[model samples]
Target: MIIGIVGGILQGMEAVYLCKHAGYTSLVIDKNPKAPAMYLADRSETCDVLKEPERAKQIFSECDAVLPAVEDLEVLEFLDSAMKEVGKPFLFDLESYRTSCSKEKSNELMARLGTPIPQPWPECGFPIIVKPSSQSGSIGVSAVKNEEQRLRALEKVAKLNDTPIQQEFVSGKSVSIEVIGNGKTAKAYVTTEVVLDSNYDCKQVVCSSNILPEKDDKEFVEIGKALGEGIGLKALMDVEAIYTKKGLRVLEIDARIPSQTPACICAATGINLLEELVCSKLGKESGKVRKDGCAIYEHYVIRGSALYTCGEKEFSHVEAPEYIKDFWGADEAITDFKTGKYEWRATVIFTGKDYQDAVHKKKQFIKNAMDNCELEEYIDRTPEMV
Candidate 1:
């Protein structure tokens, strides 16, 4: 099967993982030739999706299914129509994407449905978060502790050409849930604990039964299903929130192929969101299969030289060692041979019954790999690393 993935950046990488596990070849399209996922795809093309959507559709027509991994409104709007025009399975919930793209609208809708979202501040007051209503990840996001910071944050949001949303900063652990829908109904299949590094980027995702407090699990799943149904979701989406003293409050939702959580879900629970969406699109019943285990997805890369890496020097430095059970979104480095600089992007998933068990396995695996390897802390260097 040829799955056409319509982005090649960091966010788009997740779709590639899903495609690979489903035993399908990926036809990756990205404007940047050096996009990380392009290195991992079976085939790739460089094109400005927003500018030349017709060209993109023509290429996508050759594929069995299409996955629009981009967040740009124009590109998404194009895919919504193009998918129908090409008569191919497009794994995108444009309705949910429409709702998710606007925090202001989605929040209001969720409120009507009695969903637990961060209340608007002035009502909730400071240490509130001032962020862009349309942006994802941490783009133009600020935690304002005082009136001065709030004013600055609002200004930053406006300057960035995004709507300003003042949200009560819920202090607690963060977790995310990935759901699949077909516009009429949805299911929250899996959840993962979001482990952010010091820089606030997701470091590793831990998928296990302990992802949410036992009490919050039902509520979390119900909220996720309701949110997707509320937005009239048509495909895969991610619901992110913080677990506070009370429970999980809906922070945000992204109705696209999410980057980290899907791999974690697949690695641990054996539930592949991409596979489910694709199968559903093909009108096939995706037999539910799962396992009880905690899984940790981590990557390694050194900035210095290629000789220290195991893969072919010309491509992404990846090695399928016996110790490494699975690989997802590993990209070969695009090198300027004259310069010593290179990046080896690879992810290894470690599984066990608990967090410590998974951590111990990861520690041992990394320790063994670190000796003959020049590994460094993985950092987010995507041009659009939001």
Candidate 2:
């Protein structure tokens, strides 16, 4: 099958990587000619869908399905209309996306559904999270401990012309689960632990059987189902939460294809989310069963003589990276690493039969990268409060 993926950045790279694993041909589209995913796809086109709707439609007409990897509402709306006119399945849900884009709306919806979430500020006291209601990732987000910092955080959100959402700073293991629905019913997939960098941006994903205790894991899946069905989701969406001693506290929802977690889940389990999404749209089943396995997906940047574990935001700047098998002792990697280059980046993935085995392999992979490059130090930073 040929899958047309729009917006070749982080999400685009994910779609292309999944397509390769599923044995599907990927056709990446982006206005930026040097977009990273453009180099990884089986085929690529440089065209802005909003600027040239007809051209975009023509390009997508050749593919079996079209998937938008962008968060821009205007661009996503254009592709939705263009794909419909071309008579191809567009893998997106505009209505659900609109709801998920605003934290206020989604938070209200989750509240109505009795989904556990961080308490609103003033009621929850100091050391809260203040962030823009409409921003994605760690943009315009701040962890404020007092009124002074709260005002600063609000000002930051105001600068973006977006509303601020302040909630109690929930701390625990950051977890994520993906759900797919057909507007009527939904199914939740594997649960993965999300590791964040000091910037509160995701730096790694660990997928294994024990990400959550059996009971909590089951509850997490149910929460995903409830949210997907609540929004009447028609495509794919991921629910991120903090698994605290009090239980799971949902952070936010994104009704779009995510990057790192899906790759880690695919490596650890036999299931392919993109393939499952496609099969569901076709009224069929992928028939792939989950396996008892473990996988670690992490990103790194080599600058000067030191190797630093970086976040997805930093890795997004990768230039013309290639997919390498057995990269630096890891199972596989998507990297821009070139011998003799003082600066480079890589997203390395490795799998094992269990969590301990995976951890051992991950350490070995890091050691290999440091030794092979003759690096002076290996640095891994984490958020101060998470």
Candidate 3:
């Protein structure tokens, strides 16, 4: 099968990665010639898809399905409409995207559905996290610790004229699960734990079996299904929640193929959401998706100055260069290695018989990698936190 993927930036890489593993050909499009996913795609074209959507559709006309792997809402709307006209499996739902686009809307929906969520702003008091209602991936997010900090964060939000959502600071391990559906049918997969940097932005993902407490499994899966059914989801999506002592506090829903979490899920579990979503749209048989073992995904970069790592895991979705395969127990390596360059970044995936085995392999592999390479100061991604 062939899939036409739009946007070769962040989320786009996973679409290509998943399809490649399934042995499906993928044609990727992005305006940037060096868009990270370009090298990994089976076929790639550099084009302004927003400007030349018709051209994109023509290029994608023969594909089995068209997938939008972009974060830009406008771009997704266009792709959804264009693919509708093309009469192929356009694997996204605009209404669902819109619902998840605004934090306020999603929070209200969850509350109405009787799902636990972070308490509202002042009612929950200081140390609340404030964020732009429509942003994703912790962009334009801030944790206000005091009245002064709250005032400053509010001013920052005012400068952008964006609606800010203040939620109680939820202290717990952040976890996300993937749900695939077509409104009438939705299925939630195993959970994956999110690793955060100091700024609370995702740095890596730990995909393992039974990451969620067995006690929370049924309720957590129910929350995902409730959101999917409420939003009438028609494709793949990720539901993020904080596993608090009380229960899973619904954080926010991203009604699109997420950038990092999905890949790790496949690594740890044997399920591939992309393949299932595509085949479902095509009305073809997609076999069961289940937990196979464990997988860990992390990122690092090598530059002439020093080796640095991505603040956003999988930020560099490149294949491993032949010179860089010293690490053992690595199930797969995708790196962006430019010729004669001092800088390069690649995401490495490792699979093991079980969770403990995978964690051990990751630690050993990272130790081997960092020790052999000359240390460049850690690539500190300055907090985009407001």
Candidate 4:
């Protein structure tokens, strides 16, 4: 069997490895040649999935399935259309996938479905969060404090050249819930809570994360299940929910695997999301996901620095999921009680004898990492209390 893996980020790499482990040869395509997943693929092609969908399809004529690992709504739409034309397992049903991919559509669907959501208006609160409806990676996201701030956010949205969604900011501890589904039945992995450094705002720079069960697991599970069914979504989903006065409310839903997937959720729970996704695509109901005993914490040692490269080309780095293996410059070594050009970000996974041991390990990891790194200025959001 041959599977086509889309996008070339951390999730893409993991997805390829999972497919290979499940006895399938994988072919990868990405716009960037340096994508880490490209290095691990059975065959790599240098073609834009969005710009050259026809060419991408030609390269994967032998593919039995197509899986997306990046956050490109346009590319997903194109792939969905192309897959239907060729008669292959597209995984996501067209309409449901689109609904989850768009912020505006997802918000409207949630409201119509009677799921609790923050009012989608900046006027509801100062320092509200405004971001593109179909974007990821904190790009074009801002905190609007007032009318002036709202205007600034609009300009930023225009600069991004995409329609943006304004969400009322909810201040509290933030957590990401990982869920796996086949668009009907679903199972949720451990809920991972993230705490930011004192200098770095929790809403801005995501500093550290750990696997901890939610106080209101039932509520979150109900909402997440409803969300997937409402949109006919399948595969991996991460919903960012915050605890507020009313209840635990969802900030946003990522239809794809999250950027923090490799570190926090996987570290805490032994559940391998990529493997489950591959199984689902094959229509094999093996009950493959497991979370019997797992404990993990992931932290990134962050530092502020100006651009240190000489070129007009785009530059990106791929770390070892959630560990410090090495640096771009071989001479630089990460040290304790030290801040250099690089930060010591790592994901520590250790099985616990009991539940208490898991929680204790998470807290200990945070304390140790915090002692080594210092936080500078963060994108702080001062939302007025409602």
Query: What lDDT does the true structure give each of the candidates?
Result: 0.73, 0.93, 0.77, 0.59
Question: Model 2: per-residue lDDT, tens digit, 1-386?
Answer: 99999989999999999999999999999999999999999999999888888898899999999999999989988888888799998888999999999999999999999999999988999889999999998899999998899999999999999999999999999999999999999999999999988788899999999999999999999999999999999999999999988999999999999999999999999789999899878878999999999999999888889888888888998999999999867888999999889999999998999988888888998888888899999888733322
TM-score of each: 0.85, 0.98, 0.91, 0.69
Badly placed stretches (over 4 Å) of model 4 are 17-26, 49-55, 120-127, 162-164, 180-187, 195-215, 262-264, 294-316, 319-386
Ranking by TM-score: 2, 3, 1, 4
The local lDDT score (0 to 100) that residue 94 gets in candidate 2 is: 94
Give lDDT tens digits, candidate 3, residues 88-157.
8888888888888888899888888887899998899877988888877666788889989888887777
Q: 1-386 in candidate 4: lDDT tens per residue?
A: 67788887656765655555466777878898877667667777878977887888776666887777766667778887888787877655556556766778888888887887777783476658888887665568787788888888888888877897888887776666766677777766556664433322231112122232345766777777777777667676777778677677787777775544434334334455665665776767656554555443332334352111110011124332321232221111112223454532222343354446655654554444444344333222222211
| Number of the top-ranking candidate, with lDDT as the measure | 2
Task: Name every residue pair that clashes in candidate 4.
Answer: 127-144, 127-145, 322-347
lDDT of 4 at 294: 44
Q: 254, model 3: CA deviation in Å?
A: 1.0
lDDT of 3: 0.77
Poorest 10 consecutive residues by lDDT, candidate 3: 317-326
- If both were scored by TM-score, which would come out higher, candidate 3 or candidate 4? 3
